[model samples]
Target: MRVIDPRPLPPGVLAAFLDLLGPERAAEVRAAAVRIARGLDGGTLWHVNSTPRGGGVAEMLHVLVPLYRALGVPCRWAVVDGDERFFDTTKKLGNLAYGSTEPADRLGAGAADDYLAHLELEAAQLAGVLGPRDVLLLHDHQTAGLVPALSAKVAAVHWRCHVGVDTPTEGSAAAWAIMAPLLDRADGVVFSVAHHVPAELAGHRVAVVPPVIWPFAPKNEPLPDDATRVLLDRAGLGSGPVPGNVVADGPRDPDAPLAVQVSRWDRLKDMHGVLTAFAESVPDAHLALVGPDPAAIPDDVDQAHWFATCLDAWRALPLPTRERIRLVCLPMDDLDDNARLVNAVQRAADVVVQKSLAEGFGLTVAEAMWKSRAVVGSAVGGIAAQIDHGRTGLLLDDPHDLAGFADLVTAVTGGAVDGTALGDRAHEDVRRRYLPDGDVLATAGLLTWEIT
Candidate 1:
């Protein structure tokens, strides 16, 4: 129901990618831009989601929306307004979709009605703003409830789901059963992977669109010397001069090897696992667990609970081992600054980790790899797509295998594996596939084929 105005992003980012992409791929991008210019269909494209900050959806919009407009595509963004109860139900459904072993909270008939009523009110507000030719694109389960009302009012409604179950579980099945009708109203749906498309979606058109990272965004771009040191020190990582040879990193000792994982304090990201793996095996390497400060975003109702649990896990470690591992909550007052801090942390890390127990797609994985940092991620969902095992990055066969994770960390930090080589290849993979330029073409092609 509430909309956040998008700030202007620097234009001409795509122009720089021409050299990175070479003459052939750059021509393809130019061709897509020409197609986009020809196929406006006289409509404004609108993207709808829950929050304006945090999460992959918001982060992507922060970059993609600007790029689209800069490329001469007419697009706008809106964030839905919901109460705690609504978000609580959506969060439960999300975890269920992931087949989380945590306690199950069912969304029965009454609960579904409660959820619909809120979306109905929000849709009432949307009606006045959407024009006859305008089309709506909703992201994730958080905004799915609006599809019913939006379908009748808009030219087309495409439900794009960012979180998904790679392997269907009873909980995920139950979630789909409840959402089946609301989903049917949409003209099309988009998923991160082919497997993420639910069986129930067979009646509608579906597209597989991988989650992407902006290579030139403030968060993904490499930081300069003066800015890197000032931001790192301001973020509480200390003011030591940044090492010129390595990616800009935190303060400790210039040459100290570091392993880092930057994600929400969710159970799935397995921050505790990263800490345990480092303490048990790679004791010589320092570990940093970084996440957004909970106070920065209001929607993630479970952040405090998850963060407290991670703290409990950290406190249980021995004092000597504990001092080597740290928990960092970066300030979000300045989003660009927050992004830059993340950039520095990832670059500074000797090996970046994304040890999620379950992942829809690891945007952070691509972010790390884009910075040319070798990543060790769990072999699940989009992470499997991003990493080619021993080529771009290493993949853990099993997420829960602490010993196996420790072994890989030890191997990477000990120089048994060529991390720099892995990082170089990883950068190339992103340049070829995961860059946001592809997203523009993909979105335009999808809407062109489906909307008309």
Candidate 2:
């Protein structure tokens, strides 16, 4: 197991929220933080997840751990080490939970046994370091197995699942059957939305906590137009080609309207579907399908495969279509730089799209919304919670409806949808609902319940 030392943001960062959250909500958040600090009573608040990089969970924790720490709570983060087989099995379980049609033959009783054995071995080392008063938040299926072994050792064990399907499938049900027993020992279960809670978990105390974005994080920070241009040009993300990180067939048009979808190269994110939609319908604009380099995220075993799948889809398009599209992999050597680039890209985009087949919560939707960019997302999972159709952003009722998606894309990018007005409302909505303060207060509420 590896411990991640979160980089500290400036002191008094949360205090700035007084203006953004309004006096009443900000007071509520501050009061919750005070209560949480008192509840810990000198005990640590530990967060355990599979890795500290490469995904939304990591990006969020990077901001949140420090936020809690600054709020005077003893917050710490640790990563559980896993072998290749461990990650592969966890990925299969996640895919199953997402209701993916992919095969899950390996997610059987034997695999469950092996999974628990590995987590138990990892828990032994963790249990030794934990105090009796400490609270543990085990994130996603990757760390769910730790609940049983560590539950008795901690003050409370809260298991939070960051992924789930809108509609239950046989595969998801089977995956939950294996996961439910492990989670039964947990003091509480947290989900991104109510719909993500499986029926199997009905007996457990469940809290639907929306995921958050740190507006102060480099990824969400404001960049001036010149800085956006300089960074994009330096990274070869814009029209004037300098040596850069983006992978594309040719140079982009400097003045063309751009639509960007930034997500992991995962099947559920539907990068291929977005590519197909853009090529077939939105002829006047350029699309950039951006994600991290597959080699950077070792835990997601399917990244390389999905990246290739998108590559194949991009190649199938006509020369003219290919010219207007870019398949991008931002460098991950420096996470802050990567985030800054993502910020620039989103800031540069006319419309942001997240056409996910299923989502726990599309944090990207919130991030784009924060930037006041018009967003179009599939109405499944937490995406619906964030985007009020025809208001803050747009939503597709069916994810597989590529033509409908194209029409929506055409509507937003072509100026028929009043994207600027939508983006303005989206920004305000994010400030109200998707900020870290809300996430922290909800989590505090859950932890307080468990400890009581």
lDDT (C-alpha, whole model) for all candidates = 0.80, 0.87
Clash pairs, candidate 1, are: 1-80, 1-81, 249-348
Off by over 4 Å in 1: 17-23, 33-38, 104-109, 239-253, 450-452
Q: Provide the TM-score for each candidate, comma-separated.
A: 0.93, 0.96
Off by over 4 Å in 2: 104-109, 242-244, 450-452
Over 1-452, each residue of candidate 1 has an lDDT whose tens digit, in order, gives 87666876665665776666688877776667566655656777789999998888899998877777776777889988888888888887777777664654566557778888988999999887887777788998878889988898877888898877778888888778777778888978888877877888888888878878887788887788888777666545554543332222335555668888999877778887787777787867888888888666666777777777767777887777776777888777878878898998888889999998878888999999988998999988889889999999999989999999988877888999999999999998988888776777677677676322
Candidate number with greatest TM-score: 2
- The stretch of ten residues in a row with the least summed lDDT in candidate 2 is 100-109
Query: Candidate 2, residues 346-401: lDDT per residue as tens digits?
Result: 88889999999999998999999999999999999999999999999999999999
Clashes of 1: 3
Best by lDDT: 2
Consecutive 10-residue window with the lowest summed lDDT within model 1? 241-250
